[model samples]
Target: MNPIKLNLTGSPREIGIQHGRALYEQIRSQISIYESMFQYTSKISWSDVRDIAKEFKSPLQSLVPHIYSEMEGIAEGAELDIFDIVALNCRSEIALGRFSDGCTALSWKKSNNARVLSQNWDWTATVKNNLAMVSIEQIGKPTIYMVTEAGIVGKIGFNSAGVGTCLNAIRAKPMISSKLPIHVALRLCLESTSVGSAVKTLESLGGVASAQHILVSDSTQSLGLELSPVGNKYLTEDASGLIAHSNHFIENHYVEEPPWLSGSPIRLDRIRYLAHELIANGVSGDTITPGLLRERIFSDTYNAPQAICCKEDESRHISTRSSSLFNIVMNLNSEAPSAEVVFGRVGSGEEGPVLKMPWV
Candidate 1:
């Protein structure tokens, strides 16, 4: 399906209302699917989900009023209750064990002055049909473009400020509370004008419900942050100017090993090796175009269900029936930051036409 393009502006609530109404049916369908997934995976009922969603309201409104306003707008526009929308926003936290896997890489060359940030969003195959590309123009913020599931405010994308972000789910023992959830934090990151601001925005959230690896990049710099409910740490690129992360934590002494990180270690090593190999072969800067990156790296399906381009594995309890839902590559150095989204998985040999999103 063609991605829905939404140009939203005005007050926070107004922007959200426009977003919700424009994709109301898609939002409804997403909610239904998430509800079933929750029931089947965690045995959590709709009533419990609503109650849990309400728990984040006070913190969200007090800390990030704009995001709250957007959620309210989504509720009103989609004709669903405010708590229902909140449930969708916090689904990652609510359904902790069922999170997806991902791979992110950043590379640049001083000689040729080319740079790129790329990621493959691995998730439930069903989400492939529900994805949408949302372009948001809001007051007091840079224009943002994101590829997200309906009813979700953020995932992977870049902003007009030449800042881009990619996410990888991580697991840590004894989850705790924080001022904001990861999805909301993702929106905050995209709203940032620079890499420093993006890092500060995430650091400001003293605690988080779950763990995540937020890979952020700007025209000149790239950072990989490991955030958990307890604390956060970060890693920068080595001499090769290559930084990559999968679903597991790589920072030193962050937390106990996440038991749910199935195939994470292998995938992490594989992606890191591939990225370095490309760097050694002079695939950096403009030389590392999106198609070349896809063809050389993401198209590798060596490990079947656990490869860089993941295939479905029904037997796995965590990512049961999950595959690469989308692939995105961003040119952070461009005058108008832009991204290319491949709607389906890259390695499956069925990737859809590339959708170019030039900054507005």
Candidate 2:
């Protein structure tokens, strides 16, 4: 299925208005799915979810009012309360790692010097149709093209400034409502001109609301930020210029993280092994392209349901069954940043048609 493509410009509010109005149906759909997800995963009612979400409003208004303004516009345009939009954005923190949404992210440099950032977003299939590719144009900020949940303000995508980001939800946290949510932090990274600038901005604010690993990259470099409310750690690339992260924390962060999903370690090893193969083959420049990355690394099925290209396990409950919802590979070239997205699991014949980014 073709995801709804939205192009938004103007101030944060105006851009948000376009987002809410265009994807109103999708936004509502997201709300319903999250309501079920929260009830099943966190055992929290939807009403309580919104009440908890309100705590973020004051923090957002004080720290990053622009993003709050965009949420306001979305509420007005979608005819819902601003807190509902906030709830969707903070779903990760509110869920408190009860829900395990697996993903594998990687960053590597091509022979021609383009930095490639890619990942497979694995999650429950119930809300797959609610995903949208949103492109934003704001004054002073870089143009953003992100694939996000209908009501979410920020997520995985690249920007005009050659900065791209991918998210891997780390199921370890003491959810702090006063800090910046992971989605909001992602928006900040996309708005940054380079990875260094993005890292500085996030570090200056302490850290994010929950534990998350955001792989930020540009034409020249890539850095993995393992952010939690308490502190943050940076995971650098290897000597070969490669970084791979799954759901678990690979660094020594003194955090209480038990591997909730057994697949996290298996997938990480599989991806790293595949990435090293590229170097062994003497692949560089033109040889190291997005297509090659998808075909080689992200498509592995080493551990079945827990592999890089995940598939739903029929034995699991409906609420918990998961699969790779979509696979996106971004080529962060300073001159021309672009991405290719494939809906559904990669290499699975059930996957949707390939779509290119910066459409138009």
User: Pick by lDDT: which candidate is best?
Assistant: 2
Deviation in Å, model 2, residue 165 alpha carbon: 0.2
Q: Any runs in candidate 1 off by more than 4 Å, and if so which?
A: 100-114, 316-319
Best by TM-score: 2
lDDT of candidate 1 over 103-153, digit per residue (tens):
544444333223477888888776666777888888779988888888888
Clashing pairs in 2: 111-284, 111-285, 112-285
Question: Candidate 2 — worst ten consecutive residues by lDDT sum?
Answer: 250-259
Error (Å) of candidate 2 at residue 182 is: 0.2
